[model samples]
Target chain A: MQMSPGSRKTLLRQVPTVVWVLLGMILFFARFAPAFFTLKNAVNLLTQGSILMILCMGVIVVKITGGIELSVGAVMTLAGMVMAWALAYAKLPIPVALLLSLIVGGLCGLLNGFFVTKMDIPSFIATLGTQGIAAGISLGMNNGNVIWGLPASIGYLGNGTFLHLPVPMWLSVLAFLCSFTLLNFTPFGVYVYALGGNEQALVLTGKPAWWYKTLVYVYAGLMAGLAAIVITGRNMCAQPTVGLGMEFEAFSAVVLGGSFAAGRGTAIGTVIGVLFILILRNGLNVMGIPTYIQLAIIGPVLIGAIVLSVLVEGGAQK
Target chain B: MTLKSFLLRFSRLLALVLLSMVVAVLNPNFLKISNLINIVRQASPQIIISAGMTIVLLTGGIDLSIGSVVTLASIIAGYVLTQTKLHWSIAIVSALGSGLLCGLVSGILVAKVKLPSAIATYGMLWVGRGLAFAIMGAFPYFGFPNAFRYIGRGILLGIPVPIWIMVAVALVVYLFLKYTTLGKSIYAVGANPYAAKASGLRVDRILIYTYMLSGLLAALGGIILTARLNAVDQDIGAPFLLPAIASPVMGGTSMTGGRGGIGGTIIGTLIMTVLVNAMNLLRISSLWQQFAIGLVVVLAVWLDMWIKKKTA
Candidate 1:
């Protein structure tokens, strides 16, 4: 029974399936464990996954465009601060504040895209350079202060619920839907997959490749902006450091979703990945696992998944 | 030469100078000799780490294990210094040896096993951090000899000890990059793997040495940092990894591969280190400092585009 090639391949595939199984185990625990099954914990997991989902979507988009965006987390932090400032300090209306936040995000995203696409700079280096810039702007703008005191309406996104789901969770679902639609339903989406699959070939197609590449970044930026809204709402406050190390988490999620780091992505897979991480983290917290050990667990899971992806696709990759 | 290429290069050089000038003018204290020394000393570790990182980058690889290796090495060094009767010199070797071992593992995973560098290092990051945590508990190490502090704190007449070490490392890396066969092979490998393989270079061997060097430098940095504080913590190397890569990128390392230098990275590190310390000294709130770093990273990345557009 063990000698069959089909079973061997399935076994190899099942190696990576362990992470998905872990998700199932966590879901089971959430169902049976009194502490884990509480409404509060359920809502907690939802809100947590909300921000992670939003950030992960952007990462997926950037990855799909055949580039990495390491600065999404940094930009998210900056936008969060800006959104908070506009509502609290600038004393703007909610709509205006949202617009300003979106604009900031879009501009940052545009700059990053422009650098990588137009200037022929590598996306990783370019985004990293911008990560510092985003941090600096946040610091200079606020002098390292936290943003607070937003009107209750703007605060609704963080804690509000509809149909029993947390607001962030709803937003995450919306973002996921939008990404799926954009990637699958539109010609521009077609262009993106083609772009990632082969940049030079796409260029030879006589299209304005830069514009297509740039648009995904802007879209990613918009997603980050939305994430900031939910994140700020959840905390009812925003700080420059709010999103620190977030990009890596998002990147890890994207990778775990069975997406290639060299830039192939699927929205559905990424959503599963994001959910898997959210559940894993929340479940661990509920289990009284130490934070350090929790991080250690993530490491093994990431490696195992990646190794599984490589091994399963090794022959097919060529 | 093409006008676009020349102008692009010129603009990069000018951006480097102007950035320094802006910082200097904004704070006259930034221009002082003491501040200059401080900047170099601060950048020493990052500059060293970036040297090896640049090589890895050239080969289209990343090393997340840097943070972990540093943590492991510093702890090993710290434990030897505090708990054992072994001399400091031997302790240094033991510490650096551990870092090399981690780096070697990552390299083998990447080069031989053909695992992505990012994934391999990510695993090492955890394992290494876990080892550090297991050894040090939750508290910072404080029982080291003051003499060990000399590596971080001593000055040669007017210059800081760390600054001298930085200079020596920079010169050595530069020479290696410019003249050595292995170094040239690294560039060749990065520039075109197929071509290099056809030309009879062992790409894996080059990659292994490159990452090993990165690990060694990062470990050295952790030891210096721990010595400076007279304590080692698990958190030390973790935060520095991004900045390590960021400085080199800002200095114009082509993230794609085969385009950058130790000179540019050194300058970039100096600018960032000084800026960070100055912010701290000025007592800018932590939030603002984080915001500022984010903004600076974005702008530096954007600068390439702005310059290219201008040239176009």
Candidate 2:
């Protein structure tokens, strides 16, 4: 018997839910085998997942605008280093340093947006160029040294607990809520999805899509800046390599959440995706798998996610 | 060629000459034959890989996985030489074969599976790098035979053997693109894939062939790199990724596809090699090298766009 189109669409929509169930079962089994199912461990996983979730949110916004930003990780590093330099070297107030880092991150995003919109460069190439520049700047800032001894107030964002939960977890939740509101409630958010859906149609309506496109990148950069803050606070140090490989992780999470490369992704789905990755990594760590081997596993998982999304979405469209 | 095309093709060369003169003034050693040969030798791997990258870019695709493929290919060769009793020549062929397999996978994903080139190749990049790291446990592979080492370091006709290999590969690529039916098809496909398909061109086959060729050249580069260092490591090919891409882009190859050639890539490679060499001689910190590269990439693309706009 053939399935009806309506049924098929409903079934495709359930794919993420089914995957989440399977992931839960895996965690359940893993708890038994490796004794990794503790409440504390679960909370730890959420805490670690928070930074990635923030970064993934940014990526989702950019992806929704039909643009890719490969430089977010590098921007995160530079922002963190700048924050570290401000606090440690300049002896600035914590709030001032935080603002400085955010500004730097926003400016980097602005540069990326300018290249893509004004210079007519591809998003990937433009961001890759920025990636190198940001990374180089991070390296040059402290000559590749790690800055430690951050004040307790600064560490509060990453390490402090509120009502028995990590600050980063709360921050991530707040960020996700804000993003959901921005994406679903505002006209600018509507424009973002429209920009991805059919840019020319929006242009035909006499709207300036370029500014909206640029705004998405700026939002992404801001998220990265926030991530850098949490990362530095948690470690109590800022290093040139702190955010290395994070862009891939963010990309993987966003894509795994069923966001199409061409645009159309939800912030909630990204949260699920980030949790799945964190649980998988935590489980692997518990099982004593080497980091490199874990990396190997993530590669196939990312490809599988892409293949699944393509097939399911293609079926839905048909 | 018309004057416009000539200018477009030689602009990089002109930049190279101008930069060289400035560097020579700053450091007299820059003009020495030894330093010049060293620059060419150092740029051999870039020239080789960029030759392949030019084809990929020409087809409006990318192969970010080439860097990881280089590492994996070299590791495979290293494994064959150290773990097994295979002959050196066999090990070398197997390395190239591994790269070919990778390229085939990327091609199938892109051409048949209909995935975007960036996502598909980025996935391949992770897989390749992961395999390289997993296989060697993140350790460097050493202990190559002297004969294998000769391929990377030995001099031939007063020049490095790798440089000779690079030239030979570039010549073959030049001939292939200029004279072959398949070569012309690549340009057609990149120029407009839908139109090319409607016109009876085998677009998928062209894409697969181009990616395979890119993979093959990247593998060749890995082998030369392995031989030069007399060891294989995960990080060896990491630095080459940007340069591989930047060389072609700087050489006037359009990232959007169908507007550049190997001739431009060679000049682009020379320009990059000279820039880095000059930076070293000037005692600039190594940390700033990436900054320089990033700036060059952005400026080069901006200049290309400006020129296109003006001519139009």
Candidate 3:
């Protein structure tokens, strides 16, 4: 609460950079390819952005709690694979299958929470360990096989459109609203920020710091679980390799959205982060930029954003 | 002493020894001369890369670009061998030079431009990977020089040259870190950059040198990797990023910086090699191996923290 106005101004200015990058990407696509800016293209953007947005939101929460979880990608893979395994091999009801996947995902997070809290392990290492656990279980259950032949019900969640938006996109919006409400309007959110800003101080307050801290891990797990659902729906199968390295992408988006990894973040910022990254990728695809070049451009864009944040912060403080 | 701290120092080595025993027991041929030599050869590049990475991590900085930088070096060497037919020496130097440039760029960003090493090196990772892809356009270079093959395959005093070279390189690094003021400064910067700066140690220079060293060592890895494969491709260094950090961090280096050394890192690297050998022999399934590494990374880091807490 005692953060300087200068810092606030700096953070605000950094926020617009993401918007501009998104705007620039949209226009870049529109100018280069007419089809890139169409309603269909917008829908495509949303569908892709939904999964990433969810993952980033999860990451944002963890970061705000002053913890970084690198295992969300592996957790997503686990969730999706379990859901597919239930439906395909066990022939379970799709709803039951879906519930199982979410439960497994949350359990993965809870495992992460347990290790980090009870074991006195740092978040990064603890998650990395559990990430392997999730990946192992997901792969072992399927025996290195891709779980295909998804049921129609689950596929609908991935492919169906609701009022011109993909179902997953709708889910993303719902997730955003829910996450935002919890983060911005709840005491838990306050505690998370305070935890990130000053963990020792929070500890001194005799607040249930470990509970709130571990809750963020659970929060991440839940969001990743939701991401798994969307991703599974889209792929129509669970490939064991479904979510490797997606965690880094989420990290980049979170940073781009002006959510400091040192704590102080927002679901709103994470959503913007997801949107911006997808837009840039879509724009590159539409423009026929070689994949390599597109990937190359990402570096400069990311570095530029960071530099801008620092510079804007310096200027505002000055 | 706390139980955690006590274990941090011994668990990794114990794990290494246990893995070796398992591998050797499962396949009596595990520690055979040729296999042992092969393991050392395979590990040489990674050991060199870790040497550089240790310094960066010691300074409380992470470099995500080492893998991409290796790829870049591979392509550069590939381009040289394919395009010019340069003598082995020239080609090797150019490849290392290219990697050094990448390190310098990363260093400048982190040290001079004041960017977080994680974010900055991450930028370099994408850029470097992209550039590698752009250079080769999906084609890999083949028909490495016969001399190049010698660099990787040639034996010296009953051991592979890469192994000997790695030992020599590690000795130099170990000595430098243990005895040199520059090495001390690298640790100092990581331990407390503000304090180091206040003490009038050139923190920026020290960091820049550390990254430069990392780049060079990664290229050394690339050169050997290319020679071993006898081919260079854009994707040559893809699997290195995680393993590189996993071994060092797992060896009890604090991720928060300012602790650890070539000793633990080399042992850690050897341990990884041994574990991989075990899994391959056990046919534990690739899924389990990946999971195991991930799990071990967390365990090692946590073990280190717990031990530090217990002792302190």
In candidate 1, what are the lDDT values of residues A1-318, reduced to their tens digit? 134556666676544453555566677777766688788887787777788898887778888776878888878888988988988988988898888877888888898887777766677766776676787677668777787788888767888878977778888989999999988899988888877788788789899988999888888888888898888888888886788788888887886676664446688888777777777777778888777777666666556666656665561142
Order of models, best lDDT first? 2, 3, 1
| First chain TM-score, candidate 2 | 0.91
Q: What would the per-residue lDDT of candidate 1 be over residues B166-237, giving only the tens digit for each residue? A: 789889988998999998887788788889999999988988898888888888887787777788877878
Give the residue spans of candidate 3 off by over 4 A.
A1-15, A315-318, B1-11, B309-312
Model 2, range A1-318, lDDT digits (tens) per residue? 145557767666655642654476466647655657778878888898888988888888888787877899999999999999999989999999999888988999999999999998778778888998999999987888998878888888998999989999998998798788888999988998888889999999998888888888889999989888999998999999888879878887876676655557788888877776787778778777788898887676667666766765572241
lDDT of 3 by residue, B170-250 (tens): 999989988999999988998999999999999988988999999999999888888878988777886787778777887
Worst 10 residues of 3 chain B by lDDT: B1-10
Model 2: residues with Cα > 4 Å off, grouped in runs: A1-13, A17-32, A315-318, B1-6
The TM-score obtained for chain B by all candidates, in the order given, is 0.92, 0.96, 0.93
Which is superior by lDDT, 1 or 3? Answer: 3
What's the lDDT for candidate 3? Answer: 0.82
